[model samples]
Target: MQISRTTLAVLVVWLAAVAAWLVVAKPDMKTVQILAGEMAPATMSADGELPQRPPADADWRPLDQRVLAGWRDPYWLRWRSTAPAVQGGADRALRFSLRGASRLYWNGRPLAGNGIVGRTVAEERPGRLDIVRVLPPSAGAGTDELVVLASSQHQGLRLLSADAFAVVAPAELLYGQAMLPWLIAAFATGALAAAYLYFLAVQRGRRRRPGARLLLALCAVGLALPMVEGWRALVGYAYPWHGPRLFVLLGLHMAAAMLLPAYLARHFGLSVPMGVRIAYPATLVAVAAFMPGFDARSAAVLLLSLLASAGLLLRVQGAQEERGPILALVLAGALAMAVAHSAFLDGPYFLLLAILMGFLLLRHAAHLRALDRHNAKLREERAQLSLQLLQRGIHPHWLMNTLTCLQELIEQAPPRASRLVESLAEQFDRLRDSSTRQSVSLEDELALCRSHLDIVGLASDHPLSLQVEADDTRLSLPPGILHAQIENALTHAGTGACAQHPFRLRVRRDNDRWTLELRSARGSAPHRGRGTGTRYIEASLATAYPDGWRFVQGVDGADWCGRIELTCAS
Candidate 1:
């Protein structure tokens, strides 16, 4: 899509925000988890200290796999595993992202502690959710057992498991924690801005398009995504919040999945069956319920949504053959990116969605332009119809004048009267054919002029000739305008004067401007102010060319002259 000044400004602001955040937070990191996953529980001493020897308890279970017993006020969890190879240096550390305050022990030696861990609620102090403690250089590969004495007496969220502890370099842990909030904030800001802009556009439009609501829905989804996925980074809630956080994330995913098909259906002017809508969400919930983890549930929902939207798009591909395949490709690419990353609502995912939104905005702008053009054409047509109706009102008076001439001719000379009759008939035929039209060719108008002169000349005793000066007779002008001008000149000038010189007609073109001039020999009949014919000529020009045309008439030297100047649209 073509970016407007407002969008460019928004982009510049977003970039500035990101730059400022990077400068402030200074987090450069990677998702390199050297050691992370389920840690089996082991027995610890009554004093919340590590045992000198390994626990022989066969009841060891993955911390994340089993819910901790609620009755155990002060919990002592232990795990033993072969340490992974790492550079033995002062930079190495253990990162603990836990719900409750806790102290750690590495290989039976005191490592570090966060806040205060006690057996009772009054003795415990809440700590920062993320804690990083430097490891001694000797504790790298030599470390064998890790013990955690955690108490959930002051947890905001009642988390049951402590499986977020990981081994990493202190810099990496700090960087990851610092970078997360910035990333989430940046994307969330962008999504919110996009949603506000779309909302404003929808509100300002005189006629809302079919895709308008769909765009708003997409923006809403985009805004919700970063907020849902990155709430932890923004707010350091206790680890217990993870459960509710995952629930909210899964719910948003399912809602977005259902929203996609509906958005597509509405955008493409297709009707979605109520059954399909109901079944899709039911299916998503059913599948998500059986999923083992939040990541799996999220990925499944994304894939199902992709398939559902694609199914609808493809089913109606026959109606929108050109757009269907392209939309499918974009949807497939977006879903694939999202599914590939366990944290599906990340920066890259939103970037793809922004691109898709831009494309849709461009299409909507094009559609609006097309509608504007169509409306303009309709207005022009209505004006033409109105002009034609006005011209019809003048026909009765004109016919009476002609019949009077015919009556005079029949009594003066029956032989010439027949020719006048034919000319009158031909004039009526051409006028009937041209009346329903907006414009007629210059040649057709000239023929009409010649027919009018014939009927007048044959009826009156004066034989007249029409002097033409023009090139490119195929040019078009409002129908019957030239004919009307000729009739006006004859009726006002009193044919006795026009019998001295033939009427003059000229057509000229210069670039996009067109000029038509008609001059009649001055008659003794005094010029009368604007007549019905004059009003008719003025109205026709105003209707056809609006403000793009000028009309002027007066007696110039020895002749009466009328000039029409207009700019033709390209």
Candidate 2:
């Protein structure tokens, strides 16, 4: 695929955004754990008051587990840990999660309260699942103390599990809260690219190439799969909806299996019978619908779905001995993808391909724009050339000369007069045909040159001879090029100096270059001005051979010679 300017711009912008995000949102992180809540204060000062003096080691109970799990009654935990030494003066924070209401105290002083930590079940309030409480710079260092008075909700004898509490800086939690927003932004962008590519494919309709639309469609579908799979933290939906999220993921996975095979069949010309096609997607849907209940063995459903998708692709690929150039690019791209997968172990490979597919779509759009411009230019040039051809044939000078010659020939020889008129008409017809074409075969162009010579030969006082020596008549050249050269020769050659003069046109191919040489009698000055035959030939050659061509014209001894060498496609 071509790398377009737009692709470069997008990459640059993405990199810049990443750089800016890193610079502005630099992580000031220090990880320090102060909580292994295993506590029941031996002496309580009062219900709503702190102990005047900190409790001794003998007053607290130390358990094996860090969290206060399987505990249903209201309890107060005075979590204490010696302050870890600070380095680099990094900013500190206290982050924790709990199930029930809680109030926090730093160094035995009342600080922040979340909901209401109550002694009785009736008075209890539920706390948030997650919390981040920043510690002041004056209090972050040395001998820190936190008091979390938590009450677990009692549902008969069942104990509600509570998340452990800890103190750490935001940045220390690497793929923690900060990562969610980035993932969301990345997936949102992928969705946009997918929609745009699909729109392009649909807008192009029948003009869209095989596999182009399928590639984009697969990319769009594949990108959303990871978002659905990771919605737990990425979207932060309610935990109770876990079953529905899993269902959505399985459904998407099944859809991908169908689409992947369908792309292979459509793009690689796999002869999938109608029955097989219908059965394939049907099987995927059934598998999705009947996925095993969530358990250790339930992972087999996803593994099986992957097997089906890959199985279809391999089956189709094996049937064909021939593959397209695009298939080779796909393989090469997959190889690159493998390398990246190794490097970015946690990267969502499917969504990454969406980024690549976006670039491909841009390249396709650029290609289409270039082709459209070229076609429009050709149409314009054809219209202009057609008008020029009409005027050339209807020129009053040539018509009057031909008619006058025919009148003289009628009195002298009627049969010759009829021949002259027929040749004139044939030459006019060839000119009209040549005018409509950008290129013509050497044979057809030579025929036009010969007809013109015949008509001109009849009207000239000095006889004109024509000689064409070409090894290959299969080659194509710009239309009217040879004719224009011959016209220039007739207008300026002989000069009544030579008794007899012949116009010569020679063509041959040497290696990869096609050579055409036109030689007329040498003269002191050029016969035509810049805007006439000379300019037309130059313009036509430039348009046809923008590069890889040589045009040399000068007087060689007694001949005014011009040679054009054009490079052929490799």
Candidate 3:
């Protein structure tokens, strides 16, 4: 799994959120202890004198007391402090328990609670005493007071008692201690995300394998959720119950881990086993149970599942040739997270995972691009071979052979042969001129047909008849394509047989296509024979007029007839 730029940006936001939580809502642990202990007791005075007993809720009077802050629910309140007339240190801490949900504040500073506690709508006892350090008399005398605010959505607070004691140093406060792990987690997750995003951007332009993008997306999501939850936890936004949020966080972590093996298998082209599919999801479920009273048994289950999944991935990597870099990245990220979890080091582990994913994505993309280029080259070579074959079929040898036969006839029959010679010369001249062109006018082809008939008339004892009923001015054809059809008719209508039965040629044009029909008797009982000339004509028609040409041959009574239909070229 690779991390993209978007994922890194998301992690950065999560880090910033955690930082903000630490700054704005962090509890003043030092002040909370002092106010809870000494200031709370001194503030229970009437005017400048000590009160007879704790003030009643309805008859409580607002008096000038020592400056003390109290945190309850989400609110904080502060009041003046005053010393008690009695020199007793019996009340050193303020104790209260919330029936539903509440916060405590002392000296205008909110005390960070252990997050939401107690079960949903479940009855529970109140006044769970939390120890606190007392404030000095000079720090605001005895005028301080403790305040507790209850959640309107749940239950109210029940007051327990107060106490007084010497204040502890700021260094010993719970604020810093609680924040340490969160900060570490943020750093680790952020680093992993950054690395992954960079790799994804660099490789996005290249070709990639199927599911590569999806794998990257899943890895990115997994890395992101942990950072978000860790930040919330650090800021005291996380629920103390740890039933739902913890489960979700653990699930996200497991999902991200599971995606790792699958991603590596695809990136490095390793085969994934069937067991891995079942084990990965099961691992996530096991880890998710951690939030809902997960014990040693649940932890063992999670551990065993993870071990099996890791073994499967390792086996797949070992079977492949290119597994070193991918395996190293996965192992390093996993080890870093493991160490952080054990030590409660809160930082951005996602960042590391992201970087590893980016590397895999880039490798896969490059491989796909190379394969595409190879396939393209092969296609080009195939096209070139096909062109060479076409060139051989239409060479000039056939034309030269026909010209040699016409030359011998010119000297044998002086007058008739001279006419035949002129026609042959005109037909060859036109063919030569149009050799480089794909099409010519239909009128031109008709003239060429007349010339062909003249040459046949001179060579054979039989008469050659031609009837062209066409709007020649509006018609045209591929240069050499139609000529082959005429040649086929002449070749198949044998000269000796044609003396008894004359050969006939007819041409008609309609719409954009022209049709040619030739008829000649066999002079004896018709017998089927190979027609090489016809095959050549059909092949030429197919090559030149691919979209619109048809040739048909059949016996009509005593005559062997061949018909050709072709669309006129524009």
- Could you tell which candidate, 1 or 2, scores higher by lDDT? 1
Per-residue lDDT tens digits for candidate 3, residues 21-99, read 3454455653444433221222333354322223334233332222221222222222333343223333334433222
What lDDT tens digits, residue by residue, belong to model 1 across residues 1-570? 343554454345444543454454543344233453333333558987534444565345556623652423555556554455454555556666766667777666887687676667778776567767766655456534567776666644433344455555556556456665456466655755664575456447435566567667766776676676567666566544666777887777776777767777877768877897688778898888887666777777777776776777766645443354335444644555554565435444454444445445555666656765664665565556546544653468766877887887788888888998899888878877777777888888889889878877887768877898987565778777777777767777777778886799888888878888898876655654376566656666665664357988888899788899987653
lDDT of 2 by residue, 136-159 (tens): 544445656676666655323222
Per-residue error for 292 in candidate 2, Å, reads: 47
Question: Whose TM-score is greatest here?
Answer: 1
Q: lDDT (CA) for every model shown?
A: 0.64, 0.57, 0.48
CA error at residue 478 for candidate 2, angstroms: 3.5
- Regions of model 3 farther than 4 Å from truth: 1-207, 233-244, 269-276, 283-287, 290-309, 316-322, 332-345, 348-352, 368-570
Clashes of each: 0, 0, 78
Candidate 3: global Cα-lDDT?
0.48
**Cα miss at 341, model 3 (Å)?**
4.9
